[model samples]
Target: MSLLRILVRVALVALLSMAPLSVAAHEVQPAISDVELSEDTVTITLTTAIEPILAGVDLEGIEDTNDSPLSDRVDALRALPPETLAAELAERWPEIAERITLRAGDTRVTPVLVDVTIPEVGDTEIRRDSTLLLTAPLPDDGSPVTFGWDAELGGLIVRQGDDAQGYNAFLTSGAVTDPMPRTGVAEQNLGDVIVTYVVSGFDHIIPKGLDHILFVLGLFFYSLAWRPLLWQVSAFTVAHTATLALATLGIVQPTMWIVEALIAASIVWVGVENIWSGGRRDIGWGRIAVVFGFGLLHGLGFASVLSEFGLGQYFIASLISFNVGVEIGQLTVIAAAFLLLGLPFGSKPWYRRAVAIPGSLVIAAIASYWVLNRIGWAGDIPYLA
Candidate 1:
């Protein structure tokens, strides 16, 4: 544990120096990702990283495919009118509606795709696997053009063309998510969103994330003693577990803005407390109480996650398992922290000042900075390419 703690400390110092804010944001969502497509088809394909919640159901192109060449796609598209091309593809795959049109202020579009993929998991991509042979006359409009007439699809319609970089341009990395709810769970096409939400949400509360990791570390930093450390961990477990259940079950809610603010605040509290205080403060149960309170806020945050998912089929099992999963992930983090710092302390008096104090201060500083940035009080934190 002591040696691992040393390595963790070393890594944190190195990463923070390289690109603290940008790397931190990337922990939640990639700022920008690339996708590749052929130059001919009005169809789109995605090649990028997406949070796991989108892996299922949210397809970018076709669900299955072949090593079809880009040229094959181009030649097929050029030979057919746009309507015939859309209809034939719809006949084969069926995800696309025959006619979809909408006005977005001035822009209107219709969508057609040859395939879809979630590359973040395993370099997934959907390519144009076959040609769309239409027995109708081609429109001489010069490009894959869309009309101003309204039609059916998503609330709006759009497509890929030359101005979009190419006829075979990289489409958006986002999957077709359900409409955002105005109040309770909004009805969503949960072909896979449910499982994805649970899995990725679990992953989010783990290693690649520095802020929450630091918060978990803060929970352990105060105890240079074995018994107190045990008690604190137990209390934290109970509190987080209670809230995770309440939130997942839809028993609570906190505005998205406040939940993030408090998360930042929780980190600050643990870090600052670790630095200045130690060895059995007069208020013995104070830390436990504070953690319990923060756990409530975290629970509300958790509920929002499940609520947004809009899936009710596996509610009971998913709620329980997801809560258990969160606890396991949290404990794993604390275990790693102990391996790094615990053995070195071994109930030593000086260990508090030398390691715990300094470490806690650093964590607090980072959390406080996050709070400032989130509230828009500071300039946008510089991110990486």
Candidate 2:
């Protein structure tokens, strides 16, 4: 069985690592680029001079304000035509032009996924910023070589030849700068990094950070008993918190792969040890100390999201809110799990075998895959950093 497991792991690693033959062949010629086949989603960013608008809106309870129902506001906004939105903006145009502008039309007036992030930038007064994420599937066989977009969207659309390209454009007071070209990378935001960080951090909790979700779930599963669960959670919290703080302060730059690998390992060790090892009383604090150390690594892994968002300005507030948002996501997961899995199913025989074992196996296998994949022992193409 041991040999079989080892072989399976080895083979899986090889498969994951194997370079796609087509990609390998074309990787060097004419400086091959990543061709985005479709606009899985397009993000539109709007910038404005925030200090003045801060008066029309409240900043202190920004998150709390969102709690009120916005269905009516959404409907009203969505009902307005692009022209109406432009006219409405015309009223605020002078100040809007003074602060910031959009290359694309800002008047979606639609109930799109809009995020407003407020943070104080350097030497500048505290202000508000907004980000809009727009995702629309692409048409069949149509590629975008070059394209232009109208401000009142459904109005002006531009296109070039048959190259499927996605664009990120920034509209300022005077000219439209192709941020895509400026960054030489697709969709890299040069907005108020602080706002971007907060928006990204919040988005990650629900949408992008799947690994973090699994790790938190693994923690919740071990001894779902409140006391034991609380102990582990607290330990994990303290450790990650310490590391997150340190990493934000520039004390660490550990590779994300290692952090992830260790995170998986931590889950496996805790769960496997829980199932077989007799009593914690027998093990000294030395073992506990080891976990704390690993937790520190995990913390930095968590902070990777925020750090990638950039420390620009308002690092402190952004850091605290991001951490709070993460904790909220974590607690929400546990709360939902307990409601669904614990209350009705905790005592049943099938629950333990069905839920616990399968859960652990999945987590272990995933971690093992990540470890092998990261170590490059898998036969996969090397990606440029």
Candidate 3:
């Protein structure tokens, strides 16, 4: 066999081996904090996975704890019982506390730990969340306050007040929130909201959204012609956008695992169709319809992420901006693929045999495994769990 073929087989084997670990083994999600301001105190109740924090893993721009040098330490911390872990965090409180910033105008306020709530150790593979309740006394002059933490702690959603129009913002990279008002909802300018969420949506696609990237690639592999690719993408865009809106508005809600299973299945369907069709230049209307249907499933998946972090009072604006970012990311993927593959080798007679077919085979095989894993058919296999 030629070197290219040998290389392909090796790459496929590596992918298959790593497929199960991609499911959420040690993925780092953003931390969320609910800030409540009373006359004398500013209290923040933060909900986050405590293992990475306790293990001293730097979470900046990281998705998985395994990517850090301290991943084994993180896993070890995860095995500890709730009380044990809480006590460990208590021991580290002084160091952790200094990293948190609570400012009331020019005055720096220090917050004291009120409580720590860690869930009992369950499945070690699955993430377990812990809560921290910290409260600091307000300034005597009643100055508006702003909150931030070490960027190494990862992204944070700061929600002040309980109203729907309350001040809400996502802070990352050492960014702090706008000064929160002592009275009613603090107003966030429209332009800032747009920029924040657009970046968020784009980030989700370019680097963070691997599964979505593969699905888009599956769409691309179906045809090299612009018209066919455009039709399928347009259908997908419309369908996912609609469902993303519906789900965010709380109109359509499906069990999250079921949606995830169906999304993996969609990838399988698209990949299989590409291989069977053998790089057809024209797409059938039926193909467009199927793609649209799968897009709806994918939209629900998108909404699930948003729901976890929240959109706050700027729900409509954030939702629209995020979708726009996702579209930009999708187009970028297609453009990159075209420049690399379709532009260079698409006209060759062997392109279909050498590129599209084998690529689709890999996409299908990996997604097929995902389907089994997502639907619980794979059981608690040691590596997968």
lDDT of each: 0.46, 0.44, 0.82
Candidate 3 residues lying further than 4 Å off, grouped into runs, are 1-21, 377-385
* Pairs of residues clashing in candidate 2: 17-379, 17-380, 18-379, 18-380, 102-171, 103-171, 105-151, 144-163, 144-164
Where does the lowest 10-residue lDDT sum fall in candidate 1?
Answer: 148-157
Clashes per prediction?
A: 12, 9, 0
lDDT of 3 by residue, 54-109 (tens): 78889998777878899888888989998899888888988988998899889999
Indicate the worst ten consecutive residues by lDDT in candidate 3: 12-21
Candidate 1 RMSD to the real structure: 15.2
Candidate 2, residues 1-385, lDDT tens digits: the string is 4554444444333422222211111111000112122333234333332222322332222221122243234334334454454345446544433332222122221212234333333211111232222223333333332223223111111111112223222121123333222112333243433343444454455433445555666655555566656666677678878888888777787887677667656656654654453123234354456557767877887777544344433456556656766666667667766665656656655555555555555655555555554455434535421
Ranking by TM-score: 3, 1, 2
Task: Show model 2 residue runs off by greater than 4 Å.
Answer: 1-199, 277-291, 380-385
Where does candidate 3 clash, by residue pair?
Answer: none
Which tens-of-lDDT digit does each residue in 1-385 have in candidate 1? Answer: 5774576567445423322542234322211111112222233232222221111222223211121233344334435544564455456433323232311223333344444332122111212222222111222332322221111111111222221121111112423323212122223233343344445456546633455566677777777566666666677667666776666555555577677778778888988877666555333678778777776666665555444333244455455655655666677776766665566453565656656777777777777877776565545445411
TM-score of each: 0.52, 0.47, 0.91
